[model samples]
Each structure stands twice: as structure tokens, then as C-alpha cells.
Target: MQDNSLPVDIDRRPGATILSPRGDVDMSRAPSFRERVREAQAGRPARLVIDMGAVEYMDSSGLATLVEAMRNARTEGVELVLCALNPRVKAIFEIARLHQFFRIVPTVADAVEA
Candidate 1:
């Protein structure tokens, strides 16, 4: 667990860093999420996996934050993967045509392997 204030749990795997956030990802929480992601990327893991299984909802701000993370990951040469997205959150990315850019998978295990 990185921070108690943020609903994030960070786990370090063999070659990946997994961040699991537990709540809605709206504007109110997007900043914290961004900070958490940034911190995870700071470690320079071969892969960064965001487990969205607990996230039920996400707004544009949340999506924007993810986009920023994606850009940063590219610059850092870290593979970014998002997994366990609920239908609602997954639909948001699909509707925005972001699914084409993001490596989204159905489970954390899949993301870890990806």
C-alpha cells in the first residue's frame, strides 16, 4: 500500500508493478490516481499493470489522466497495461476510441502476461 489517503495498493511482481485502485475514478480522485501511477512508473518496471477490477466508474478526467500516463509510459519505455475493467469503464474507453491505444485485458493475470 503506497498511501492510505488514496485507494491504491501497489504490488511488485517478478517484472511488473501492479496498481489496484478501489473506487470511482472521477475528477475528485483522478489526481491521486495519477500520482500513484507516476510513482509506480518511477520504479521503471518492465510492465505497469493497472487493475481496474474495483473501479466501477470513470469520468473524462480519469480518462485524461490515463492518456497522460500512457504518454509518459511511452517516454519511459515502460509497458502500460490496464486490466479487469468493468463494462462501464471499458465502454468509456471504447466510446472514446481509446481502446485502440490502450492495452486492455479482462484480467490481471492476462495483463501481467501481456
Candidate 2:
């Protein structure tokens, strides 16, 4: 198994690709997170969903990484969605006003459908 600092599971479906990241996403792990995202985007899926249910903490670096990913997704014409954000991660988004720009869903099913 690959030793990922931030464990991420990529599920590539027909149209939407889901990236599930577990554990805290801080400075030490943002790079790994970003790499995983890049790997997911490399497939050129129609939509990208970030399932944040298992992430309990995320620092600014993590948020910045996500912002960068969002920009990349926009440029690539890939729909970026965030699903199942735990309360802490959701608060971070709200604090950064990122929630206003991101498509956040209550569940993975909703993200895939969206």
C-alpha cells in the first residue's frame, strides 16, 4: 500500500469522481491531498466530488490546496463538488467564505447526482 500522509480514496465513476480524504488535513498533509486531487483530475472526469466526512481538521494550507484545485477544475471544465463535510471542516469553509463558491452536498449520492 502506498504510504500516503493523508489517506485519500479515489472512486472514479462514469461521470463523477469522488475523492474521500480521511484524517486531519493540515500543512503536513495538504501536499498529499493535492496530489490525490491531481490524480483524480488526471482522469478528466465530468465532475469531482470531495467527501470530507472523515476529515476532522483542516488548516489554512488545506483550504488553500482545495482552492487551487477548484481553480484547476474550473479551467478544466470539471464540476467541483464537496460532500459530507464534517462540522469542523464546514466551519472552515464558512469562515473562508468558500462555501459560498463551492457546491456542498449532504451526501455522496447527492454529489454524484449533482
Candidate 3:
């Protein structure tokens, strides 16, 4: 596992891609997050799962990046799902009513299958 102060690792799986992001995804790091996510999606896998179990903080920029990713995935016909969102992150999505927009799963495996 590649470790960084930002705490995110992306692992590509066959027929599915996993973005295991950890730590805060705020303004300073949001661009990197977006770039990494976009790179992951470039594979055009049938499934794109973002594993957020370790994400402790996410600013609006992060949310926007996620929305953009979902948009790209939709346009590309790739199934995108977010998984293991901590309470704060989940609440952000809930408040934004984004919970209804994307498939939120409890685990990476579930997201992969979804």
C-alpha cells in the first residue's frame, strides 16, 4: 500500500476500479483527489468504487470533485459507487441530498458488485 500524508490509495481491480481514499480531502488536496479519481476512471471499468472508510474530512471542493466524477461516469456508462463514508462525510452528502444521486454502499466489495 502506498502511504502519504494525505492518506489515500487507489487500487485498480479487474473489471472494477477501487479508490481507497483516506484522510481529509480538502481544498489543498482536492485537486490531487480529482486527478487521481479521473485517472482511475480512465480505465473505463464497468464499476468505479470509491472507498472512503478513512476519510476524516471533506470540503465542498471534494464534494464537487465527486459530483464531477459521477457525471463523467454516467456519460461514459460506468457504474460509480461510493462506499464506507464516515458520519461527517455521509452527513454532507445527506444534507446535499446527494445520497439519492449516487449508489452509496457499506463496503468496497459491495460497491464493486453494484
Q: Number of the top candidate by TM-score?
A: 2
Predicted candidate 1 versus true structure: per-residue lDDT over 1-114, tens digit per residue? 443245999999989999999988887788899999999999999999999999989989889989999999999999999999999999999899999999988899999987
Candidates, ranked, TM-score: 2, 1, 3
Candidates sorted by lDDT, best first: 1, 2, 3
Q: RMSD to the native, candidate 2?
A: 2.3
Question: Please, what are the lDDT tens digits per residue for candidate 3 over residues 1-114?
Answer: 533335468787788888887778988878888888888888898888899998998878889999999999999999998999999999999888888998998988788776
Per-candidate TM equals 0.93, 0.94, 0.90
Query: For candidate 3, what is the lDDT?
Result: 0.86
Clashes of each: 0, 0, 0
- How well does candidate 1 score on lDDT at residue 16? 95
Candidate 2 — worst ten consecutive residues by lDDT sum?
Answer: 1-10
User: Which model, 1 or 2, shows the larger TM-score?
Assistant: 2
Give residue 93's lDDT in candidate 3 (0 to 100). 93
| Candidate 3: Cα lDDT at 11 | 82
Where model 1 places Cα greater than 4 Å from the true spot, the runs are 1-5
Evaluation by TM-score, superior candidate among 2 and 3: 2
TM-score (C-alpha) between model 3 and the true structure: 0.90
